[model samples]
Structure formats: C-alpha cells, structure tokens
Target: MGIEIEQKILGHARDAHPHECCGLLLGRGGRIEQIRPAANVHREPATHFEIDPQALLDAHRAARDGGPQVLGYYHSHPTTLPEPSATDRARAAGDGSIWAIVGEGRVTWWRDEKDGFAPLPYALRDG
Candidate 1:
C-alpha cells in the first residue's frame, strides 16, 4: 500500500466520523493504487457499512474493460479498533481478497482467508 492510499482511507474515515464509511481498493500484486469511495447504503450506517451495490458492479465492469483488478474492500470502524469485527467475518466470502479497516487513526490490512481474516503486513511506498 502506498502511504498516500493509506492517508486517503483515513481521510475518508474522518470525513465520515461517527458513521462507518466504505469503499473499494483497486490495485495489483498486493499494492493499492487507487481508492474508490462507495456510498454506505446500510440502513444503520452509524454501526454498519454496506458498500453500494452499483459500485461493486462498476468495479467488475471496469476490470473486464482492462481496469485494475478488484484488489479488495475497505471500511471504517468509527469507534472500535482497526480490526475486523464479528460481523465482518460473517460477511466475508473467504475468497482471499484483501480487507482494509481504518479506525483509531490507523489503517490495518487483512487477508480474507477460508478460516478467517488474517492480519496482513504492508509496506508504505513513497508517493
């Protein structure tokens, strides 16, 4: 992940303070190159986050059109630690995609594994 990307994620989190923000990460080979902010359509956005379905669709379509791969998804915790909550685990599909959680002035990455979300180490590239 580039430091710039990480900062953007945090900025989104701050902009949505008191509510959970959500978005998609576009990149390749374990590096995030872009951040796409998606509308949080969850009924209770303060505690839950549901990325707008259309955003997901557009991402896939762009991939088919030679855009960056759907590297992963990102969301904020609002008041909790920058880690996946139980709800996150339940919603995960175990597809081994990256998951970035932003909160508490930090951004953490995880790998959605078949068993669970494993913490992922990342290096920030100068941007």
Candidate 2:
C-alpha cells in the first residue's frame, strides 16, 4: 500500500465525520493499488458499516473481467480509536483478508485470520 492510499482513506474518514465509511480495496498479491468507495448500508452507519452489496458484486464481476482483484476492505472510525472495535470483531469473517481502519488521520492495518484480527505491517510506497 502507498502512503497516498492511506491519505485518501484518512480524508474519507474525516469527510464521513460521525458516520462510518466503507470501501473495497483493489489490488494484487497483498498490495493495494486502489480504493473504491462504497455506500455504508448498515442500519447504524454511525457505528457500523456494510458495504453495498451491489457494489461488491460489481467489483467481483469486474475482477472476473480482468480488473484488479478484490483484495480487502477499509472502513473508518469517526470518533473512536483506530483499532478494531468489538463490533468489528463480531462481524469479521475470519477469511484472512486485509482490513484497514482509519481514525484520527491515521490508519491501522489488520489481517482477519481464522484466530482473530492480527496487526499487519506494510510499507508506504511513493507513486
């Protein structure tokens, strides 16, 4: 992932303010190349996020059409800490996908493994 992507995620998180924002990460081999913003269709957008199902489907379809792979997801914590919340833990699928949580202008990366969410180290590259 690039620092530029982190900056974009932080900016989206800030723009979302009290509401959580969600998006899909398009990438390859664990490296994120792009962030596609999606609608947070959760009933309580302030505290939770559910990426719009249609958007998710479209992304998958695009990937089938030779687009970037759907590598992971990103979300924001408007006023809370950057770490994953209890709600996040409960909802995680444990599929070993990357999850980025943005808060306070910073982003924390995690891997949703079978056991739990584990911290992931990543380099911020310049484009």
Candidate 3:
C-alpha cells in the first residue's frame, strides 16, 4: 500500500464514524493504485458492511477492460482493533484476497486463506 492510500483509508474510517466504511482495493502485482469507496449497503451499517454489488460488478468489468485488477477489499472496524473480527473471519471466502482493516487509529493487513486470515505485512511505498 502507498502512504496516500493508507491515509485515505484512515480518513474514510473517521468520516464514517459510527458506521463502518467499505471499499475496493484496486491495483496489480504489489502496488495499490487506487481505492474506490463503495456504499455500505448492509442493513446494520454500524456493525457490518456489504460493498454495493454494483460496485463490485463494475470493478470486475473495468478490470476485464484493462483497468486495474481487483486486488481485494477494505473495511473499517470503528470500535475495535485493526485486526479481523470474528464476523470478518466468518464472512471471508478464503479466495486469497488481501484485506485491509482500519480501526483505532491504525490499519492492519490480512490475507484471507482457507483456514483463516493470516497477517500480511506491507511496506508503505512512496508514490
């Protein structure tokens, strides 16, 4: 992740405040080129998030058209640590997508694996 993207995630979390913010991680290889903020359409926005299906579909379509790859997803925890919560673990598809969880003034990365989420260390690359 780039420092700018990290800042944006934190900012999104702050802006969402009581509700969780969700979005897409867009890029290729080891670089994240953009963050697309998506509407959290979950019924209980305060505790969970469901990225608008349209946003996901659009991202895939764009990727097929030579846009950035759909690297993974991101969401905020609001009141918890930046680690994956039980709810997160349960919802993960284990498709090896990267997940960035923002909370408590920090951000943590994880790789959703078949067993569970594994901590993923990332360096902030200069943009």
TM per candidate comes to 0.97, 0.97, 0.97
lDDT of 3: 0.93
lDDT of each: 0.93, 0.91, 0.93
| Worst 10-residue lDDT window, candidate 1 | 26-35
TM-score of the candidate numbered 3? 0.97
Cα lDDT for residue 29, model 2?
Answer: 76
Tell me the tens digit of each residue's lDDT in model 1 across 1-127. Answer: 6789989999999999899999999987667899999999999999999999999999999988988889899999999999999999999999989999988999999999999999998889888
Off by over 4 Å in 3: none
Task: Report the C-alpha lDDT of model 3 over 1-117, residue by residue, as the tens digit.
Answer: 689999999899999989999999999885788899999999999999999999999999999999999989999999889999999999999999999999899989999999999
Superposed by TM-score, candidate 2 places the C-alpha of residue 107 at a distance from the truth, in angstroms, of 0.3
Give candidate 1 regions above 4 Å deviation.
none
lDDT of 2 by residue, 32-109 (tens): 999999999999999899999999999999999999999899999988888989999999999999999988778999
RMSD of each: 0.8, 0.8, 0.7
